[model samples]
Target chain A: MGGYGEVHYTNPTGPGTPPVASLARFVVYLAHSFDDRLALRSELEVEDAKVEGGAAGGEVSLEQAYLDYRLAERLTLRTGLVLPPIGIINETHEPPSFNGVERPGFDHDVIPTTWRELGVGVVGTVPGKVGLAYRVYLVNGIRAEGFSGDQGIRGGRQEGQDASFANPSFTGRLEWAQPGWKVGASFWYGGTADTNSAVGRGAFAAPVTLLSADARYERGPLALRGVVANVSVSDAQAINAAYGQSVGSRIAGGYLEAAYKLLQTLSAFARHERYDTQADVPVGVTRDRSLARRITTLGVTYKPTWNTAFKGDYQLVRNAAGAGEHQVLSLGVGYQF
Target chain B: MQQPAHPAAPPAKVAASIARLFGPGARVDTVSVDTTDVLRVSRADSLLGFAAVGNVLGKDQPITFLVAIDPADRLMDVDILVYREPYGGEVAYEPWRRQFRGKTAADSVRVGKEIRSISGATISVHAVTLGVKRLLAVLTAWHRSGAIR
Candidate 1:
């Protein structure tokens, strides 16, 4: 399980700009294997600190539930809800996996992680000095009506709840790993429009295409990682007109991070990220410059054991629109058993 | 966590592996394998080495691995027999596991230092390191007590 909280300051030197505290998350991750060929994995998460049948501040969600079956030495079959292999953090964002109090903003805003879809796929590895892995799957399409200017198509994620099947998306990822270096690339192609003829929301032709690449390197006590991602929407004009929102035609972002382990169980790290959800707006639609943002984080982590971690970090946030700059301090703890 | 019913490695395969290590003509026997799946390997009337199979949780599931130690109490090899996790299968790759060869209790076998960390398999890396450490501790005690020769 992992728990995180942060204090945010909307304005640095302005009166009445008191810092805001948020209980970002508390999560439980679980996995059970019945045999070598079959297993079940799941996660339950709570956000915003509290929940009263979901009427209060916090929300409870089933983050993932999947079944896996080994088909061969190098291949496995998976079904049910699965996190798509994309950015560095999407599939392995356990709190201890990173140094920051919060996940990288580039992953949250542009890649829109914690992203899962009900799907079926196969994953495999080629055994060698230069290791190779590949995964491919199909899932329900996104919903265009849910796209927005600020959140981009993040809200369009149906999360497999009675997801529409008018169009299915295909996603694939390939990775190469070595003793000290790892690199990967992924692609997603799908339609966001799930309009019904009777409801007549709009023409169902908003196609979402994404490409991503990431790499990580570690030697001795130092670790380095970077990720670059971009998404392009076909028929963006139609999507904007249908939804009455300024969803951009293109979204892109990336981040670079470095960390040094100073002790057996202690480390210091830093990361810099830049993201623009509205990097390219639909024709005739004004772009929201505030959606273009950059952030830097400095943090430290103490892990008494490999399964647990205590973390603290400070962040500096800036926007391209010249909006109010802000700073944040956060703390967190995480454990797995 | 429910332990997988599957053997860390197939019995026939494990036997073949031991034979190949000692010599194609040598006879092999499984002295005892407990609930933790630690196997006691024997050759003829003397202890040739010790072997064990165990599971360590990776990102989301258990990774089944095998460890073989020579009679001199040094690691002979480590193999990832089954990797059930969806990603980070690099831990099972042969080159990565080869790093464990020749390691002994005197060595730290730490993940970030002596053992190289895998990018996506950070957890598995730590898990394997710790598992090997514990296994070495047990094997060293047995050796010192003259339980194996």
Candidate 2:
């Protein structure tokens, strides 16, 4: 659970943007093992405080539903709805597992954390000092019609609905890890336009590709991490003119975070995040500075147990437009079993 | 969904690890842990050490690993014979595994302290640390109670 209060600083003396408290999300993870070689895992989530099942309500969706089969010591087969092996949190996010009250903006706007799709894949590791892991999958692709000027591909994610397969996508990740250090790279490439759908009546397949990389280091009481991500769209000019939306040809951003444990159960962290959902537009389209966001967050997390945490953070969000900068104070508590 | 229950290291891998720890010519015995046989590495019937393999949850899935303890109850070495998770393979690295050497129950044998933590592999690091702690505790008990000599 999470709640935050925000005040716009664009006009310091004037009335600020409203402050609000919200229960951000509730999620449940389930897994069942059939034996030593096969298992099933799933995550069901509720966004916002409630879901009325009527006109005005929150949303409920499945984040992961997959089965894993161990084919060998280093190789495994996985099928069903699975989070693409991208970014740091897309596959490992269980609330208590992270440091901030909310996820990094780069993950939300660029990499799209919790981005799962119906697919099948192989995941394996090569052991030693130069430990390595790799994943490759064939999955359903996004829809261009859902792409927007403000959210970029955030809305384009089909989330494993009756997803189209006119042009399947491929997502892959590779990581190299050593004592106290890990570095990884991931990518997603596919066609978004449905050649058969009316929206693509006369347009070529609009291919969308995303590339990302991250690194982390932890030793003793200190931890450091950073991530960089960018999405490039082909045929954005025509697609924007046809859909009347300003989905940029490129959206990019990244973040860096550092944390130190003051005590066994208490830690202080600071993060800097920057992202521009509309970083680059088509030749004739205008860029919206507001779409480009940068924020510095300071926070502390208290963990009474390994799988539970209470967090509080203050975010100083800078407005690129220089019109509505704001500060947000947030608190949250989370647990996982 | 069929999951692996009590998934131990494969026989060939277990044998190879034992030979590596002891010598290639050392004698190996299979001692019974309830109904399951645990590997006992030795030379000419004199006990060199015991090889214990077990599984613990690493993030969402189980990580299977082996622990080798010398006669004095100190860890000789740790070898990740089989790891089922996707992200925490760092625990299998030789340098990271080497950190647990010579540690006993008297030591914390916990991550973020005695054992260095692996970034992005926190769960696996913690799990293995706890596993080593538990192994030491069991070995200490056996030594004190005369179950092991």
Candidate 3:
């Protein structure tokens, strides 16, 4: 048994917005080895730290629950709710592993991280001097009713909650890693119109396609990371018309980060991100410029131990519309065991 | 943590690997000590090197690995014998293990320092680094004390 958690203090530099302190997340991990060939792994999470009967906000959810069966040296079958193998932060987002107090905006708006769905997949590594790893899965599809212009397909994530299987999606990732460098590419293709007759009902109706590439390099005290992703939606106009919503046909974004370890316990980092949820709007719909965003973050992280981090960061948030620009100051402490 | 005992006899694959690494005529003998067991390799009255098996926790389960050292106390090679974790098995890859070659007990043997860190296998990388460092220290002590000479 093990767990991880984080606490945060944030002060957004905007009118009438009060500074807030909160327990951002608390998680517990459980695992059982049934035998030499099979095992079960699970993670239970609490967001906002509490969930009361009448509370307005807070949630308790399962982030991961899967069984792994080792079939060979190069193959393992995984079944149950699983995180799609895409992008850097999706599967390896332990707070101590990242730089800023909060995750990059590109991950939040473009990738919709902490995203999981019911699926079965195979994960393995190819034996060679060139270390190669891969994962592939087929998962339940998203619900188009939750699609929106500002969030794109993020709200559509079923998160394994009675997820509809009428429109299944395929997702996979391939990564090549060596001592000082790692590079990866991933893709997700699936339909979202799950039993919504107005948008037509079929596995291929209102399909969403996503492609992403990411790279990380670390040598000595300097580390660099970058990720880019593009998402395309088919039959967006029909879905928007049927649901009375403004959904985009394409959403795109990326981020670049660099960090340097000034001391064994302290590291400094900076990141720049740009994303547009409404990169391209469907016919008869007006694009919202505010949905296009740029964020620049500068931060420092102190790690007294490998599994604990104290973080502080300043964020300059900008939008194409230029009306709601704001700055944010955040501090946080996080740990994993 | 208590050290796990090495098997009474090295597996055939491991024996073959030892022969392949040290030469066909290399002979290995088990040397039991207070802390752990060591495999002393030699070829006709001349010492070739020493090899020890060590186990370290990776995430939740133990990862068993073998470390070989030359007469000069520098690492000759590292091999993962058994890995039970579902993830972080990348630590067993050749390219990653190769980093330990020629390193001595005096070296840091730290992840992100002398050793390169794997993207998704931080915990295992760290655990193995420390385990190898500890094994190197034990071998160095044995070498100085004439425990196996």
Candidate 4:
């Protein structure tokens, strides 16, 4: 019937104070309309401490209830228990859409965004002079360590962990927009569940290939972007590929970003990332691999209304060959209806 | 995690737009839409324009609108004007831009092969279902070719 609640406090770093992150949640967002052509929505979430225990500790399921049928600016046809569309905020969560107070840290720990499952898919647009958009699906993949942004937002849109087997894996994405250059590429195959230990020595072998690419440029006010990724696995666990990271092993990563609004309220951001966790790391030693450093964000957002948002950022972490530099500071507030 | 895009608006002061749901004035006329291609609301209050297809405009970006109506019957009081990308209330909860209200012209034209697709506003419900079926087949062929009304 209704849902919205938030409370966070984590002032622990020293001085023996206490408050290392006490989180609470209550969600039940709804939007029903079976007549305009059927638009049923449901998001039931109640977690007093989800990532802490599991199975929705505070309790309540139905994170997303679906049924949409508008079918044509390009094409449409959705099926229930979904989410895994992957990337860009895992289905556009609306905090001014996105720009650092949150979102974009290797798309959330690496390839996870609005992640979801229980498939049935289609996206639109065609007849291109220069317009091609697509998002194809058939879900339920990813447990990477028991995720719960669904299958969509683990970071940016599927992949950072989870869904190796238990069959039902197939994800495809293709995008190309005109005027302000845009490019996208995605592919995935799910299935894994065989092991002798050491990460599970290729137990259910066959199925681990990932590739990603994105590029953008928007004239006027100024905008530019870039992204790259690659994943390959199932070597009978070469030793967990050599030691441990997850999903068959062998990995790659990339990032580059820029922004400037300067005023309208204010806008300024910066991002620089490098992750190799050994690159896909199963065993390591491509120079000993493991690189997860970052020089991210000096953000800003202060919207009075347009869906409300007030966020701030600063994080300069390191490791992955760079050594520990750890610097953190962040604040956030988001709303949508 | 790559973006430089920051231009919600700047170009078009007015080039071609007429998908009106009404606001500035009110009861005008000239309607016809069907999408895939064929748009021209002629003028009722003119505003409608959309595009956002999957994860709609949040996960990676794909948002555009010229606004006016289709706030999906919020008692119908639409008048947005402009917005390039990034949540205008998730494109005002686009359910294919609320299929452009009421329905007329001997009504009979669901959307995109009848209609069905919205998982997190896949491209803003396919640009409000192809801008309300291309402004209802160009305001029903400009009201059987009368032109204005």
Candidate 5:
């Protein structure tokens, strides 16, 4: 067993919000090898450090619990609660693995990261030097009733807690990796009705479709990576009408980051992101400009060891509405073992 | 799809790799010490290098690889012969392996220090690094003791 955690101090330059220091996340990872052909992997996570009875202070959840059955060198079958193969950060979000103290806003609003569901999937690499890999899974789908304008389908995630499978979804990713470069594309398609009569009860009712592409290139002291994604809700109007909501019919966003190593243990990076959760609304609903956001961040990370990082960053956050703009200064220390 | 858990590259494959690194007409002879067998490569009367085949645990399974060292004790190349895990195979990429070139046993050979770290492949990278370091140390000791000379 091993674990990782992060502590953060953030000072936001916005009214009514006070500077605070907190333990952002603490996670424990466990894995067991049953045999040469089978293994179990899991992670338990705590957010905000504490969870009191009845008060909204913190949360504890199982992030991943999966069994991997190796059928061949190029193929493996995975079952149980598994993360959907989406953008770069969703599967490899260890604090030391990313540049900023926080994940990119694009991942938060557009991808709804840490996204996982009860599912079964196949993952494998094609034999040869081209370094191609693929993953595909069928999992429980989101619930349309939980969709909202601000968070889009993020709230709809059932997180494998007695999740409804009336509307199943299929998600897949194809990646090509080689020396110094990696590129990937992913897709998630499924229905969200979840047996809700108002949204219909079919597997494809009120469907949610997401497509994304990401790339990374690292050579010597310079590294660069980026991701773009688009999400569409097929029956948004009907669902909104039935639920008295304003869920968007479309959402889109992307971010690009570049890092340059200044020393063996220090690096500087900058990132720019733009996302609109309510990019498009139903024919009769008005879109919320605040749901469209743009953020720019500049940061430096000092890694005294491979599994530890000290990070600090300044961020400029803005919205299309031209209101509620803010800047933040954040410092954090994170580690994995 | 089928892969051996503790695989050794076929003789022809190993020979081809030797020829590529030591040039054509190079001959190979195995020197067994304890349970380990080290390959000695030479072209005519001049010694080219030594190659070691080994496996290291990656996540859950063994990653079999070949590491070649020059007579001067610098790493010439690293080649992954078989990668059993579904993930972390990026450790076998040419660019990652290239980092080992010219590194001697005197170097740290630690991941995230003298050697760069790859995101999402940390475990495999660390395992391979330790494997290479262990092999280098063994080779250095053998040379110093004139056990294979």
Candidate 6:
């Protein structure tokens, strides 16, 4: 039932081969400004999508389609298919705008990048009257399945996981910058509800919860950043009899990273990440017996132009059951308008 | 970006100078400037503060001048320097900057109240304008009077 759903939305699995998700879309944008103090801008996108690989693109649906208003010099609000500010990469999700063909492997573990919902946001300069000029933003929460990784480890925030209605949630960031120096801090909090029938003859759900924070500093061509995040769910009322049985315990993870720019368009970076699910930890340090996952990455990013990048890297992965590692090569292309 | 002190300067003298102005915690470190790593002050901590305080300086172009009630007050003076900004720098040069001389701090703060905003760089103009106004107040009352020395 999970893989394949209602027949009305599901087109035949081809002439009987495999089903394909069809997400047709259209978009338009308009922008104008006067005296720079005031500006008008808008965007519209239409979506029609279906799962492609798993059950061969599960169903057809409308994904993201909205309009935005850059009302004042530093404030912008968007509704309709409202974009949710999830992680560092998602808000800045233009393909050509980042390092790898895709975002980092760790970012998705909590806040799925590019996950959008019907909501709104405000982005602009932080007051400006105080001291250093800083920028800040607040956005809505995204759909559950839309917030996590393939296995729901990163951002599996499925509570109130409505594809149609976005729940009340907020994400924000503040940054201070000078000629060659920059520093920033960001936070995220939200609520969700999860439903499943794994334990009962009838379907039921558990509550979805999340909290996270991060900080970073950049000087000249060098940068350093750290993040700590957690996903929580009180399965006490879980329909699944597995309760504390099959389910390990809780969920938490975080990482620290550093990078150096080799050129205006190229950078060398290394990151260390740790995570654990179905277990608990003290001070972000995992205490589970053998369910710990640690990933260390070393890579280089080449940007031939402002909006595009080429990346190559290797990750050293360690699990409590002894340690081993592998190299995965990635190629990706991205852009924004 | 803050200026790097000359390499020939004695390390102790450089440290003393920096501490005089920025206090003791400020330490120089290696950082990528453009594409090469060079030893200088930590860019992460100061750059943003610098950018916030940016409006005063011109880009790549440097101009140094002393400010005092009279030329005889050179020893008790305030030094104003401009660098690295193309569009807004025009406001800091000649015709516009000339308006700054001999005026009190209340003279041109908002720019809108006393002077017209620069055409191309609004934020830069405002920042620089405000910095100049504040610097004048600081120099005339404190630094020139030896409070900083």
* Candidate DockQ scores, in order: 0.58, 0.55, 0.48, 0.05, 0.25, 0.02
What lDDT tens digits, residue by residue, belong to model 5 across residues B1-149? 32344666657767777777888887899999777889999878898889888888776567878888988888899887767565688887777888899988898786655677665688789889999888888887787688876
Runs in model 3 lying further than 4 Å from the true structure: B1-13
lDDT of 2 by residue, B28-51 (tens): 777665554556778876889877
lDDT over C-alpha atoms for residue B47 of model 1: 65
Badly placed stretches (over 4 Å) of model 2 are A1-18, A127-129, A196-204, B1-9, B31-38, B57-62
Model 4 segments beyond 4 Å from truth?
A: A1-84, A89-109, A112-121, A124-135, A138-169, A172-188, A191-204, A209-262, A269-289, A299-317, A320-337, B1-75, B79-149
Per-candidate local distance difference test:
0.76, 0.78, 0.88, 0.46, 0.86, 0.42
Tens digits of per-residue lDDT for model 5 on A49-92? 99999998888999999999989767899999999999999998
In DockQ, how does model 5 score against the reference complex?
Answer: 0.25
Cα deviation of A332 in candidate 3 (Å)? 0.4
Clashes found in each candidate (C-alpha, N, C closer than 3 A)? 0, 11, 0, 84, 0, 32
The numbered model that scores best in TM-score is 3
**Deviation from native of the Cα of residue A127 in model 4, angstroms:** 26
Candidate 2 accuracy as lDDT: 0.78
**What TM-score would chain B receive for each of the candidates shown?**
0.79, 0.91, 0.89, 0.26, 0.91, 0.43
Q: Which ten residues in a row have the lowest lDDT in candidate 2 chain A?
A: A1-10
Backbone clash pairs for candidate 5 read none
Report the lDDT of model 6 for residue A334. Answer: 32
Off by over 4 Å in 6: A1-65, A70-74, A128-150, A153-167, A173-188, A194-209, A235-249, A279-291, A323-325, A332-337, B1-149
Please write out the lDDT profile of model 2 over residues A1-337, one tens digit for every residue: 1111111112112265555555566777677767667877777877776688565866788888888898987788999998888889787676666788778877787887779999999988765425788899999888887788878887878788898777689999998877878899999998888763534542236888899999988878898999998899876777787788888899999999999999999999999999898888888789989888998989999999877888888888885896677777777777765
Top model number, DockQ: 1
Task: Please list the Cα RMSD from the true structure of every candidate, rounded to 1 decimal place.
Answer: 3.6, 4.0, 2.3, 19.3, 3.9, 17.1
lDDT of 2 at B79: 82
